[model samples]
Target: MAENKRDYYEVLGISKNADDAAIKKAYRVLAKKYHPDANPGDKNAEKMFKEASEAYAVLSDPEKRRQYDQFGHAAFEGGAGGSGGFGGFDFSSFEGADIFGDIFGDLFGGGRRHSGPSNGPIQGANVRTSVRLTFEEAIFGCEKEISINYKEECSTCHGSGAKPGTTPETCTKCNGKGKVMYTQQSFFGTVQNVQTCSACGGSGKVIKDKCSACRGSGYVIKKKTFKVKIPAGIDNGLSVRMAGGGEPGVNGGPRGDLLVSAVVSDHPIFKRQDINIFSTVPVSFTKAALGGKINIKTVDGEVEYEVKPGTQTDTKIRLKGKGVPSLRSSSLRGDHYVTLVVQVPTMMTPAQKEALRAYDEAMNAFTKNDEKTRKKGFFSK
Candidate 1:
């Protein structure tokens, strides 16, 4: 009798809109709980493993999920050996099927043994990446290129690592079973143990001839270029995600993702303070005392600013909306503060020194007149 199917989402305990990360996380947790390795002699654990694996198989595939979502298990009614079908069922008729025999021996009974091949899909490991950006590029957001040393899909054998006109055959050592059994001596007594077959390398397949290009490794070192856009106002140490940019998948699984860590370079002239910029511009002593329009440098361009008469040294001149642009709000910008630094004249000519002496004498006469007027004042006494 065909058993009724449960909702895929219900089986994985997630919503229909669950993201890839959410789905993978849920699978990881559930898979660990019911892993056959963790529950060695429990028949119920074996059943749960098959059930969870079946659920993941459908939900992970977009097309399969769409069909399952619309028609339920009935949509896959004729899918032999599918989640609810038994057409692809194994009869345990193969050499070295003892691996499955050992597995079933623990589940059903120690006396029963099976001889069949193993089949399943597994995922690869995740990888990390970093990128460097200029200070201006980070502030204004720019695209950058990077070189990565990672495993890419093999091209010679199309990732199969097999030579032309030849294909990988089922492992003869384990008879495509992917595992082997051996007897071990222990204090308890003689025991039989099942382990992955070394000859087939656990993939249950053997290559008759290796591809010359990849040297049978199935992957080659590649220099891949990727463009990354830095948003305006992105601070240092911020991370950007590039999905499916990691290493190739295993057993036809989905590829992992690439995580980019941005490191921004420093600017020579501009100093950032959140959204503000500050700098010191040197002005001549005459410019400070005479009070006139002077050209000041800014990020936008040079602008003429009026200096007040007798402006003191080190005075800050604020230019609104001329500083760093805000990353979050493009319409708003910070102010730029230019501190005035009065420069004294050096290496004066002979005539220039004489004019300074004459100005001092004229100033002394006015000082005497001011002293005389103060003595007759009532407040002075």
Candidate 2:
């Protein structure tokens, strides 16, 4: 038996100098891959699993590993190919062997299922949704209705999942504990595996006559309406949270929150930053050259602004407290910046074009006369 046995380190695919963590890490990979739960009814995988488990049982223990490294498999046997003594070594007697729980936890979803009821309160997940808002609605705040696909207990059966005249029966397979236990023999010892009751789908009670309204799920999906008060100054993609407006909670826990993301529509004449509003107002070339009142569109309304004389194109002007209202305080407001874009006429009547040409000639003649007058004044001085 000893002569036919392979080296412990080779079985686990580790080195002679491999640390405890490395040994456990290598064993975890093999165990997860070749475990009976993963590869069911596969004899080759089971054989590999047994080999790996035996290798881990020997190598994980410091004293056993030291003995194996010095004397090899013969250390566990009475003699070469002997059947007595270390040949029948029970690895379940290995010291501090709590790693099985951790390995099993990883194989399962974290916690090990025990042969008992585990129906407990767990918080529901949050629900996300989006709401479309106009640019001004987001700036000045507005109330909007949001539709939610919500779940609630059926009114006909009141979450029992049974008909109105019937009640649920206790699960016979798991004895109402919602779990079933079975034993699996491994190198260490008998590993008792617990699973959810297949008959009742882990629910302690089973409905004989199902509720027609809920189809035996104890809950029904319905369209729920919620009035969401969108805050002023809420920007696009920002969310508004409504408590208890999401999906129905399980096991009587509180319902999740409804997160509504604001999708603000773009305005035709305006753009916004954090708190400031920006807009480009087209001013006629004549109005820019000669100062005059122009109507500027703002979020509040159309306001009259005086264009400064000789105002260049793309000149920026500020309107105090004309931007978005503060979300925290309605009394506070941001400034609106207006860019005056001078608009030149692309086409002109023949008479208008001739008048422009005459004005240009007159200006050039006036410039020459002014220069001559300046030279004469200097000479006389």
Candidate whose TM-score is highest? 2
lDDT of each: 0.70, 0.82
Residue 361 CA displacement from its true place in model 1, Å = 4.7
Estimate, for each residue in 138-234, the C-alpha lDDT of model 2 and write its tens digit: 9999999988788888999998889999999998898887777766666445455667778887667788999999999888998989899999999
Off by over 4 Å in 1: 1-135, 147-151, 163-209, 235-240, 258-266, 359-381
Supply candidate 2's per-residue lDDT for 349: 100
Candidate 2 regions with alpha-carbon error over 4 angstroms = 1-118, 125-128, 172-202, 221-223, 326-334, 347-351, 366-381
Candidate 2 residue 45 Cα shift, in angstroms, is 17
By summed lDDT, the worst window of 10 consecutive residues in model 1 runs over 87-96
TM-score of 1: 0.52
Specify the poorest-scoring 10-residue window by lDDT in model 2. Answer: 78-87
